[model samples]
Target: MKEIRLAARPVGWPTAETFEIAETPVPEPGPGQVLIRNVYMSVDPYMRGRMNDVKSYMPPFAVGEPLDGGAIGEVVTSHAENVPVGSYVVHSLGWREYSVADAARVRVVDPAAAPTLSAYLGLLGMTGLTAYVGLLDIAQFKEGDTVFVSGAAGAVGSVVGQIARLRGAKRVIGSAGSAEKTRHLIDDLGFDAAFNYKDAPVRDQLRAAAPDGVDVYFDNVGGDHLEAAISTLNKFGRIAMCGAIAQYNDVAPPAAPRNLASAIGKEINLRGFLVGNHSHRMPDFVAEVGGWLRSGRITARETIVDGLENAPEAFLGLLRGDNTGKMVVKLG
Candidate 1:
């Protein structure tokens, strides 16, 4: 078996040298444990924060320790009655070819229930759940509201836009890093309008796209996008501060969102959230989003790299805005 471990903590952008793949013997399952042969692993933007040796919502990834994220695998061996061998499960022991974990820690998933086995790591997993909770709860989205999402073509952002549309939003707008992503939002994802943030000032683009004013903002890319949304927000507008990918790798603090004071006058309700804190909503999330997905009312997209050795490049590509939706690594 092989596992990828953190070689060093990065100063700014992480390079290939940041990770190292090492071979190790596979371990046996304990009395209450199962052994999983990983088939897929996820690489998300949030994993970047884990690289730093600082305190935050989640613990930091230690040097010399194998990095872990969302992963789905087949149970090759099991000692617990609830988990059977040959069943598939999702857990947090990625960056490795196989994993041994307590039976209570893994959730069995039926591959027949989803379009692909990897869907459990994205659409039916935390990625989809984040979008569901952020829009419906944190942002307090309602009928006929104008909604805008930054990083609108990525995993969570893409789902947020579609849900707002399906739930009776008056309009759905999004901002992406490239022309192709913007086009994906407008033409394929049912977005009312989308703009490439690289083309012009976000405030100008947002003002033109949403002249009537935005009633809800699902912020995935903070800084300029947050500032623009603040300027265009109608009074009592709601904001779900989901992420700030725009400043994830920055060595210095972000300097924009200079118009935060405008949020107060506009009565903007900004709330930051972590999906882990809202596990109570999973049943609701899976039911609703799962219906939309099964009925073809929503789309789940992913970018899969072929091997575990390339997971580091996958993470670097994700941070550079190279992947359009959920970025995951496919393993054998």
Candidate 2:
């Protein structure tokens, strides 16, 4: 078996030199454990924060330890009576070809629920859950609300836009880094309007897109985008601060949104959330989003990078805005 480990902590953006791949003997399953052959793994923006040796909601990846995220695998051997062999399970043990984990840590996923097992790592898994909770619960999205999302073409943002549209939001606007992504937002993802953030200032584009003002802001890219949303937010608006991918790899501290003061007078509610903190909502999320997915009201888009060796590159590509939706690394 092969596993990718962190070789060094990066100052800014990580490079090829930051990772080291090593081969090791596949371990046997112990009592109350399962041995898994990984099929797919997710490389998300949040993984960058885990690379640094700092305190966070989640622990940092150690220099010599194999990096792990979200992974789906087939159980090759199971000592636990509940987790039988050949069962497909989702676990937090990625960046490796195989994994040996206690059965308690793995959740059995139904591949039939979606198009593929990889869907569990993206749409039906953490990424999809993040969008569902952020929009519907945290933001208190209501019918006829005008919603704007930054990082609008990302895994979470793409789903957020579609859910907002399906839930009867009057208008859905998004901002992506490229014109092609912006086009994907409008033409494919059912976004009413989208703009290339690279082409012009976000405030001007958002102002033009939603002249009446936005009721909900799903923030994925936080710097100027947050400021832009704050400026255009209507009274009693809501902002779900899901992520700040814009400054994830920066060495310096990110600048606060310049126009955040507008949020006070506008009575805008801004809340930062972690999907792990809201596991209570998972059942409802799976039911609603699962129904939308099964009925074709929702779409699951992904950019798969073949092989475990390329997982680091795939993660870097995600940060660079090279992927359309969820970025997954195929191991099998």
Q: Kindly report which residue stretches of model 2 are placed more than 4 angstroms away from their true locations once superposed.
A: none
Tens-place lDDT per residue, model 1, 1-332, is: 99999999998899988999999899899999999999999999999999999999889999999999999999999999999999999999899999998999998998999999989988899998999899999999999999999989998899999999999999999999999999899888899999999999999999999989999999998899999999999999999999999999899999988888887788889999999999899999889989999999999678889999999999999999999888899997
Question: Whole-model lDDT, candidate 1?
Answer: 0.93
Which residue pairs in candidate 1 collide?
A: none
**279-307 per-residue lDDT for model 2 (tens digits):** 89889999999999889999968999999
Worst 10 residues of 2 by lDDT: 253-262
- TM-score of decoy 1: 0.98
lDDT of each candidate versus the true structure: 0.93, 0.93
lDDT of 2 at 104: 100
